[model samples]
Target: MSASDSSPELSSEIALLRQPGLIGCLAGRNLSAFSSQVQAVAVGWQIYALTHSAAALGFAGLAQFLPMLLLTLPAGHVADQFNRRRIVITCQVIEASAACLMAIASWQHWIGAWALYVLVALFGACRAFEMPAQQTFLPAIVPVSLFPRAAALSSSLFQVACIAGPSLGGVLYGFGADTCYALCAIGFAISALATSSIRLRFPARQRQPITLESVMGGIAFLRRQRPMFGAISLDLFAVLLGGATALLPLYAEDILHAGPVALGFLRAGPAMGAVLMAGIMTRWPIRHNAGRTMFFSVAVFGVATIVFGLSHSILVSILALMVLGAADVVSVMVRGALVQLGTPDEMRGRVSAVNMLFIGSSNQLGEFESGMMAAWMGAVPAVVIGGVGTLIVTVLWMRLFPGLRDLDRLDDIKPAD
Candidate 1:
């Protein structure tokens, strides 16, 4: 078969890569990911410095995710209702502007823990709008056949930024917190500018008056799909329980006695593993029983998390985290590609939005769980327990949803007209 006729394979991906706007969009996403990690590392450092409390660090993590919970559905609605490119660009601007404000606050030494939390809340609000818009917009840029490759490519680039950003943030923090914040601002600004240059034709949806009913329809649809709910909820529960990320600042400060540069390495460890995994996925797409693959990957992730939690040495922790990251990347790739393929074009935004809720909950609620648990049991113990808990959840999910594991193809789940 000629390349175009091949199932969403690498050659098909090459065709999409030849398109005009994709590179620019990819570049924008890279910069955006960089800025986000920088912001996170800086904030984590600042909170830890001020409070010397792991719980506080967890709360800082929570602040960023809380708004995602509130705005994700509405944001998804707006993405579906309007121009996705425009929505993405607007979100980029908002995020960049927020970064600028944060930089100024840092320069002036005006930021407190509470103020930082508030700023992160605002960042999260922008994120809710940004993610769905971007996710839905990709199919417009590339053919549906190339989505797996596109997903892998996007995942790889994002992981690269993630790998670099944290290490850079840590080094910059050693020089000055303000410098890290400034870098974040610059990253965001570049992302905003790059996003502006991309253009695409978006599919139109019939206008429906905004109401709770309208939003709930999407929720109800997702609720009825066992694989969709299982995939999303498994991620939510596993990550929330196994979230050792929120405790990194504490580990850097108290246990490892690492400086900012070391902190960056600590943060980048997972991304490095994820980058490697993403690159492999690019070459070899998950072809059969991808849901089962995701489950196994997450199980490995939980085990790695447990190892990370128990390790006191930086080297061991980094190794454990790298493994966790690798595992998580596998799961993320399968789940992301599946969701994109499974959801209808018209319902993509809403379904993506529902997915975002799980993403936010897994990430943010995990932070909260980590923080509260750290408060009660101490950071080390909390992370350790959370990791074990993630393993348990993974096993339970496997037993509870056999169909999820048997999911063989995205084309199998298309909604009937």
Candidate 2:
């Protein structure tokens, strides 16, 4: 369907599935996300089993985050300057190779803690290039009018993967870590194949010369787009402060006195809620009050976080987390639409890189902040304080970015010249 086609079918989720190239991109996204999640579970279990140290597990995450922190901008430059499809395919191939190596090492019983860290870091570096290129695919292949629905549907599929992958990984790990790694390798290989099948309707335009100025252009572009800056930064601070997922282990064992099964439920709660919300948005796309809705969603996220922090019941905590997840998906869909629709195609890679950086930072630093505060005072107090901090950030952002707050429609946002 064309962007201008306003038939009743245009509003349906089936319309997006029918779009040429979209199904391949969606398949690629789902497979890659599932592989990453499965790999995460296997790595965490294997790392702890090998070293029996919490600190080593922490280093594993750091190993992954560090590459994303260091290589994202340069990767973004490469995405804009080269064939994005080829970059995505190459990264997935690298990821498949890394997974294969991990499988071989696990089968040989020769995988050490450092080996796991090295492989995880390799996966991270590939993600730095893969994400920005993959992110551009939706906008490049779909009509602008269908972008919001497409984003929502995409999030739904990813959340499904997130919810399912760990459970499957845990089951496969009982067979052997090698078994898990082998499956991950297959997933990555299939993801690469799926992405290779897509044909971009709006291919990346190579416009900028190879210069420092060109590499840094996304930052400059974001600076001029006030709404985009506000929306993205709002997510950064809100998530940074309100992140309570890092404390789930403590909450399950200490606060709620629940066991590992409860912990599993707690982890899955948010993804379940996110998937539900994404499905709702896919069916009934946000047509008006786009900005206020986003702000309201963030506020809801803070409120949910606070509730989860104060809850002594696992049921209450899980419910709070579900609300938090639902709220977060709204903010995410809005911010993603704003970022993709407001920026020009040539700059989308760089801008998406910066966005990915903020997302990565928020997740890593949020965990650190939660752990520090939990150690300093207590888990309850740490999470409560973080939730309250999120509320304060939301209020402050509303005043600072009136343009975003007052914004009305996602389709109204035009690509900056």
Error of 1 at 155 (Å): 0.6
What TM-score does model 2 achieve against the real structure? 0.90
**Tens digits of per-residue lDDT for model 2, 131-173:** 9888899998888878888898999998888777766776777
Q: Among all windows of ten consecutive residues in candidate 1, which has the lowest summed lDDT? A: 408-417
> Can you write out model 1's per-residue Cα lDDT over 283-322, one digit (the tens) per residue?
7867778878888999898889888888889999898989
Candidate 2 clashing pairs?
none
All candidates: TM-score = 0.95, 0.90
How much does each candidate deviate from the true structure in C-alpha RMSD? 2.4, 3.2
